[model samples]
Target: MAAGTRSRTGASAAEVATRIREAIFAGELVPNQRLVEADLAEAYGASRGHVRTALGELTVEGLVERIQNRGARVRSVPLEEALEIVEVRAAVEALCAARAAERVTDEQAERLRGIGRRMEDAVREGDQAAYAQGNKDLHGAVIGLADQRTAAATIDRLRAQAVRFQYRLSARPGRSQTSLPEHLAIIEAVCARDPEAAARAMREHLASVARAIAESARD
Candidate 1:
């Protein structure tokens, strides 16, 4: 009986954590926003213990921060930290793309192209959230082709750290429109099975994002 109760508690915490994560990624919960446990418990129809457990998990993921007397709030990565994160992401993803280009199957190549096409359609429709989700999938597809689980996990964690900026960048006028072509370049290189070009394309894509964010900060 005791073990069964603990198992159910763990499941509830995980479910609450997932819903809160979706809220963050979907822009329903912006960075630095305070998360009161009572409110969250009420909102998620979960117990305060479950809410606290979920927040603790997200804190590990770098999506939330717990402060003295402040409880918890969505984390906001500093601009300098964000720049560093992107640089690391560039190197990591570039290698992944290069490796993937050499090993990707025909079906994976087709899926990459399909994700790019869907992104293009999202851009045209001005569906920023959809485009952002596609962008996430596109990056995952590239990493998936690399067949490195450890690298994939590292990238996923870094992405969660950097995603608030990504959403902020997506809100910049014409940013997504310009980024679509960069995605194409990466897809084109992957499709052609050009490892060097794929690496270069991935690097260029991240560089462009860094530049856009920098430029936006200037304005």
Candidate 2:
């Protein structure tokens, strides 16, 4: 792992779980690194049982894997997994975009603008991590504006994995700069109440991510 492991601020097992999940998504927990329960427990000030429990949850998400007697480690996401997630992301985003077009209100629009502004600030500060976090808040706002509870919930679930380990590759080059514009496009399309345009823009944006992932794997 090029980046040193993190000791995040969350205290409880559940909070640690979130921290770990975020680390995975941010590529802080690099692929194939052995996850020592003792190390994690100490780092998070959690019990071994708590760390184990957290690992089990991530395993179900396919973000980690357990070896019979060896212990747990961050899973190396296969090429197929990335492609599948990308496809699902496209479909879900398209639906959300369409629904948002129909349901997004003026207040939601203002809220989104605020989120975008914060995201832009993060970018200007050159804080990729903060920028990424802000981007997530913005996306959640967009989908939440659609008011489709089921769709919103499903996208949230999928995002755990979709976002997992993405930042490792995302840190490569130009991702942060490009992402803001892409997000702005999605917001614009939905604001215009053009479902097809929104869907197409979202699809293209996600597809670009897939291309980046593929290129990263080759490198």
Candidate 3:
């Protein structure tokens, strides 16, 4: 009975941790924002112990940090570190893009093209939200198509850490106009089953992103 209860609690903790992670990714929980155990417990409908455990897990994931005496808060990934993260993503996602091109089915190719169309429409209609969603869909589709669990997991964590910078870049004026072609190029390469081109496109896109991050830092 005790073992069963413990298992249930652990499951709940994992669930709560996922919720918190999603909240952070969705920008509901901003960097440096205090994570009060009581508040989290009440909001997530979990016990304080569960919240504590969830926070601990997130801390290990680099999403949370505990101060000497102020409990825990969302960790603020610095611009320099964010730039480094993007550099790493460039390499990893480039490999994924190439693998995706090699493995993409006809149906998956069409789906990627559809995402490109949506992105195009979003840019033309000046719909930042839709454009952002398409961007996510496109990358997610490529990652899924790659069929590399380890690479996918690494990208997920890296994305979580750099989501704030991504948001900033997305909101930049003329950013969509610039990135739209880059995204389309990636879709085209993958849909055409051109692994080298797909890899090149992915690296070029991330290089542009790295440049933008550096530019932002300069400004």
Name the candidate, 1 or 2, with the larger lDDT value: 1
Q: Write the per-residue lDDT of candidate 3 for residues 1-219, one digit (tens) a residue.
A: 221133443346777888999998998899999999999888877778878888998999999999989999999999989989999999999999999999999999999999999999999999999999999999999999999999999998899988888888888899899999999999999999999999999999999998997787687
lDDT order, best first, reads 3, 1, 2
Which of 2 and 3 is the better model by TM-score? Answer: 3
lDDT of 1 by residue, 18-131 (tens): 889888867789889999999998888777888888899899988899999989999989888888889999999999999989998899889999999999999999998889
Score each candidate by Cα lDDT. 0.87, 0.75, 0.90
Candidate 1 least-lDDT 10 residues = 1-10
Q: Is candidate 1 or candidate 3 better by TM-score?
A: 3
Against the true structure, candidate 2 reaches a TM-score of 0.75
Residue pairs clashing in model 3 are none
For every candidate in turn, the CA RMSD to the true structure comes to 2.9, 6.5, 2.3
Those runs of model 1 whose alpha carbons end farther than 4 Å from true positions after fitting are 1-11, 121-130
Error of 2 at 120 (Å): 6.5
